[model samples]
Target chain A: MHRNPSRPLSPHLTIWKWGPHMLVSILHRVTGVGVGIAGAAALVWWLLAASEGATAYATFLEWATWEWALLIWIPLSWGLIQHTLSGLRHMVMDIGAGYELSTNKTWANITVVASVLLTVLLWLYIFYGRG
Target chain B: MSMEIPLGRVRGLGAAGEGAEHWWQERLTSIAAFLLLVWLAVSLLRLPGLDHRTVASWLADPFAAVPMLLFVGVAFWHLKLGLQVVVEDYVHDDGSKLFWILLINFASILGAAFALFAVLKIAFAGSAE
Candidate 1:
């Protein structure tokens, strides 16, 4: 790809407002690409499972039980939550909403907060009991 | 006389009308993709080191099957959208831009459908043997 020196420079993170919706859009793309990488890793795991015997698969099973895996899982879950919410925001914008400055900001705030909360609840479900 | 524009030619074009349509569809599918993506991620995490049978069982469940297919479809759509913008912006040559646009669209859709079909066959083929 040819880099265009003359094209307008995109807003730098340092100079940017770092508002909720803006942050959401940035993170959504980041996390979407992140998921794609993680999915590739999972695909490798699948291929390994297919070729290797059950014992090898069990080793992976043991790894899955670790707290460290949970640490990784939390961010992934958060990514999912953030991406899904941001996508919804984009869809709403597609249909025309939150165009007014105030409404846009409010919805953006909603998306950011909801995503984190959802991620937290997901971890709670995984780690703690329903009771 | 310099060719005078007909009323139809002037009025027919909406506000970058077709561009907007493409943009909206991209976004709509992206939303769908994101939801299905979450499902796929969570399901994969759950799988860990499941055997073929257990994995098949999970895939066989309609819950998993439906989302997997949806994820594939939506992912391709989103890819198509993103690539379209890239082609439009970067490839100024009309011939090359058109070629890339068509090529990428074809490849993405085919890849998505093939992936979905492969997963579905493994899930439903009824023979773990």
Candidate 2:
């Protein structure tokens, strides 16, 4: 891990022009934290409530289904969808393919578009199809 | 060719030799989570309802209980792996990074254990209707 003071520096995010790949990379981390905290906490809360008997379960549904809760729920669902899709892109890169600039950008854009689209579809099913 | 000195080359490791195993486990858990999450979504969609009685009884079934356990376990495992990397990237101080990594591991275990307990309680006891 020794470093020479005069050695050339490696390229970094600040040096490169931003692209979808960068966007997706940053988003992968952001959405990962978002989902890991908010989504998992919510799921844990739901399960705990469910196990706490009928009244507790009803209380959870009341709060969770409230319109205001969409503030947390919408972003959470989007985060989960986005993270899942972007993680797939990471998997592709982990295998060492998709490094070509055009190929990388294409997959990155596709991951973004598909995640948003899938999140909408998921909500639609929840609201309408389930009703 | 790697620019390692002969002895270092023979040893075949970078400064942190533990990385490859971490990388592999992360991917393995990610794959498991992907499959399990999909199965969970589809099964939930097919459920009769999400009411207490309905969902509880569904969970009580072995078919539903087993996969639920696996899904919860793998999701938390993947979360721990990913969270550790995030901590390493941001927390530069050795002490803080160690603290955060330990916190991440503990939180993941607690989350998964809480979830497993809830699922098991329903599987064994909550089916009383």
Candidate 3:
């Protein structure tokens, strides 16, 4: 038994030509796991810290706002946004709408862009509008 | 023409017929989560800051605390359901998939319980802090 020398195997990521809808579809799962798991941990920590004492709350805030923490914080926020938007897109499709190739791709594109834009605007409101 | 046997014609859908329940729960929770999550983002931004007093007093209110608890409960529930599928789809080994699913269930419950406890504590005794 022999396989073709140059043939790509089943379910290989590199074998497929990528599309916007595929990116959004994959992002839906990626964001769901990332935000649901890691973000919940952070939120729970925040809650616990707040429940304990002012000193504990301060400690949590200090790290949460630390410059390096932005790496995790930003992505967590973005993932939450993307997951929400993509879930909405999926909901539309789930209801037996948006299945046409063009409609599906269009909504996928919108989900990607809106998620990013909304995340940015959220931060902007936090930093600038609040001030 | 239907590909239905006599028994199949009598019973509709999957063998267990509960797959749709999982799917329906996911979507139901998603709708709730979407609304609650948006509310959370907006409420957080409304606060002057994330200082202990500001945040604690915010959570101290029934209005704030209730939604947060719902968010925690709904979110963890949704994640458990969603992650179960993820593990099933990806983890080919039966033992491994089962292990992951069990962990997800236990961890989600623990996480939601912890958050709920914290929120409750704040609501009851936040001012004392």
Instruction: Give the alpha carbon lDDT tens digit for every residue of A1-131 in model 2.
Output: 79897987876746777789989999999999888877788878888888888899999989999999998988888888889899988998999988998999999999999989988898899889876
lDDT of model number 3:
0.88
User: Model 3 over residues A1-131: C-alpha lDDT tens digits?
Assistant: 59996986777866778888999999999999998899989989999999998999989999998999989988899999899888988888888999899988888999989988988997787768877
Ranking by lDDT: 3, 2, 1
What candidate 1 gets wrong by more than 4 Å, as runs, is A1-16, A40-67, B1-22, B34-52, B61-67, B83-118, B127-129
lDDT of 1 by residue, B12-107 (tens): 343332475677687778768767776775686577535656766676677777777677777767767766665676678878988988987776
Clashing pairs in 3: none
**Span of ten consecutive residues with least summed lDDT in model 2 chain B:** B9-18
**Candidate lDDT values, in order:** 0.67, 0.86, 0.88
Question: What TM-score does each of the candidates earn?
Answer: 0.61, 0.88, 0.88
All-Cα superposition RMSD per candidate: 8.2, 4.9, 5.3
Clashes of each: 0, 0, 0
Please give the lDDT score at residue A117 for candidate 1: 93
User: Which stretch of 10 consecutive residues in model 1 chain B shows the poorest summed lDDT?
Assistant: B9-18
Candidate 1 accuracy as lDDT: 0.67
